[model samples]
Target: MDTSALNEALAFKSYDKIADICDNLMLQVASEGVAFQDEWPYAVHLLGHIYINDINSARFLWKKIPVAVKEGQPELQAVWEIGQRVWMKDYGGVHEAIREFSWSAQTQGIVAAFSELYTKRMFELLVSAYSTISIQDTAVFLGMTEEDAANYAVQRGWTVDSESQTMTVRKHKVATEQKLDPSKLQRLTEYVFQLEH
Candidate 1:
C-alpha cells in the first residue's frame, strides 16, 4: 500500500481523490477479497479522515472495517470514537479525544490541519444538536466570551437568554403546501395545486 501517496493526498485535503481511492479499494474488495491484509482497514480509516467532521460517514466507514482489524488498530477505533463524541453533542469531548489520539508520522501529515477544522465543526454540531448550552461551555469551546457567543448564535438564527446566558437554536420550519389527493377528492377544485412531476 502506498500510504505515502495517500497521506500526501490527505495532507493536501484532496477529498474527491481520497473518496475515489476509497471507492476503488472497496470495489476491489468486492470483486476479490482483501487484496492486502492492511488495505481494508486503512482505506476505511482514510475515509474516516476525509469525513472527520461528518459523523455519519465516519460511522459507516467504521462499520465497514472488519472487527478483527478494528482491534488491531486502536487508532482507527479512536477515529470512530471522535465521530461518536460529535454525535453525542460532546464538542469538548470531541476536541479532547482528537488531541489525545495518537498521530503517527504517517498520520501526522494528513491529520495536522484537522484540529482547528474539526474543533469548529464540533462546535457547529453542538449548536445544532442542543437548543440550550451553558454559556461557559460555548465560551470555552469557541474561545470567545458569552456576548460573542450570543452574537454568533443570533447570526446563525439562534436566540440567547441574556439573564441565564443560555443559547437556543431556532428551528427552521419546512414549508409544505397541503395538497388534496386527486384520487381521494370527490371533486377537483377549479384551482388545484398540482406538483410538478
Candidate 2:
C-alpha cells in the first residue's frame, strides 16, 4: 500500500474520511499481523498511536481559533469535520457510536467548538513533556530543562510528581484509571489525558 495515501487521507481534514482511513489502515495492520502469524509488533502499534495522537493534537490546536477567525474562515468547520471522520473511525469493536477515543465524547462532548479547545489544551500538555530529550548512548537531545518542562506541563493543569519524577496526566471522566489500551492508538489518547491532568 502507498504510505503517501495515509498522508493524503490525513490532510483531507474530513472527519468521516479520516475515520474511514484510520479504520482501513488499522484493518490492514491487523491482517498483516495475522498473515505473519505474529502478534502485532510494538512498532506497528506505535505508528497507529502516533497517527491518533497527532490528529488529537491537531484537534487541540483547532480550539485556539479566535472568534474572528471562525467568522472569517467558516470553511474551517468543514476541514475539522473531515478530519474527525478520517481520524475517529471505530477501531474494531472498541467504540460504540462515533470513532473517537473511548472517553472522548463522554469527557468533552462531540461539539466541534468544545472539542477544538479541549484538544488544544491536551496538546499543550503533551508538548510540554518534551522540553528536553536524552539519548540512550550518551547522546543528547537538548531542549527545555526538566524543571522548566515540568513547569510548562504544570501550567496546563498537570500534577507533576516531584517525588517520583513521573508525570501523571488526568483525563476528563475517569480519574482513577491511569493506563489506557496497550495499542499505540490507545496510548496516544491516554498520553494526552496524562498530560492534561
Candidate 3:
C-alpha cells in the first residue's frame, strides 16, 4: 500500500483529513478486490477518529477491522485499547493506555497530538464545570501529576489552597454584543406596521 499521502497528511498534522483518505483508499482497494498490503493505515485511521473524539466512529472502525490484522499489529491493538477507554469515558485509562504503548515512529506523532488535544479539552471542561475541585481529581482528569495539575491551575489564574489541596477555577465573564441585521430589522418593522394597520 502506498502510504505517501497518509504520511504527508500526518506531517501536516491534518488529522481530520486522515479518515477520508483512509476510507477512500480502502474503498478503492476493495473495488479492485485487493487486500491491504499493510495494516498500519487502519490503525492510523482509527486514531484519527479518536483524535477527533469521535468514539462512535472509532468503535465502528475497530469492529470492522479483521481479527487477524488486529492481532498481527500490536500497535493497532494499542490504539484500539485507547479507543475502548475513550468509549467508556475513562479519562485515566486513556492516559494509561497511551503511556503503556511503545508506539512506532509512524504513529507516535498522531498519538502525541491526540494526548495534547485531549488534555486541553479536559482542562476546558473542568474549568466550566467546577468552581473548586480537588487537586488529585484535577490531576486524574488532566492526565498530569498532582503538582503539575496544581501548577497548571495556578498558571490559568486559578487559586490553589495548599492546606485543602483544592484549586478554585477562575471563570472569565464573556461579553456578548448582539448585532441586528438592517435588512431583517426593516422587514420585521414593515411586518409589524402591516399588522398594526
lDDT per residue, candidate 2, 1-197, as tens digits? 43355455434433334434544665786666643222212122222323344566455445544455545543344344434543664222112122333322212222343234334543444445444222210011112346654565566555665565665543344357666557987888889999999
- Stretches off by above 4 angstroms in model 2 are 9-22, 26-45, 50-146, 150-197
State the lDDT of candidate 1 residue by residue for 1-197, as single tens digits.
34554556666776435645655656766677546656554634553445545556666667777788788987776766666776786666766766787776645644555655664565666656777887777766754566776676678787777788787767557689999898667444433544322
- Write out the backbone clash pairs for model 1: none
- Candidate 3: Cα lDDT at 48: 87
Q: Could you give candidate 3's per-residue lDDT for residues 1-197 as a string of tens digits?
A: 67788889999989878887887887877888877746448789999889888888888888888888888889899999999988888988889999998998878999999999988888999988999999999999988899999998899999999999998999878889999999999999999999999
- All candidates' TM-scores? 0.56, 0.21, 0.87
| Better candidate number, 1 or 3, judged by lDDT | 3
Q: Model 3: what TM-score?
A: 0.87
Every candidate's lDDT: 0.63, 0.41, 0.88
| Candidate with best TM-score | 3
Candidate number of the best lDDT? 3
Q: What is the C-alpha RMSD of each candidate to the true structure, in Å?
A: 6.9, 21.5, 4.4
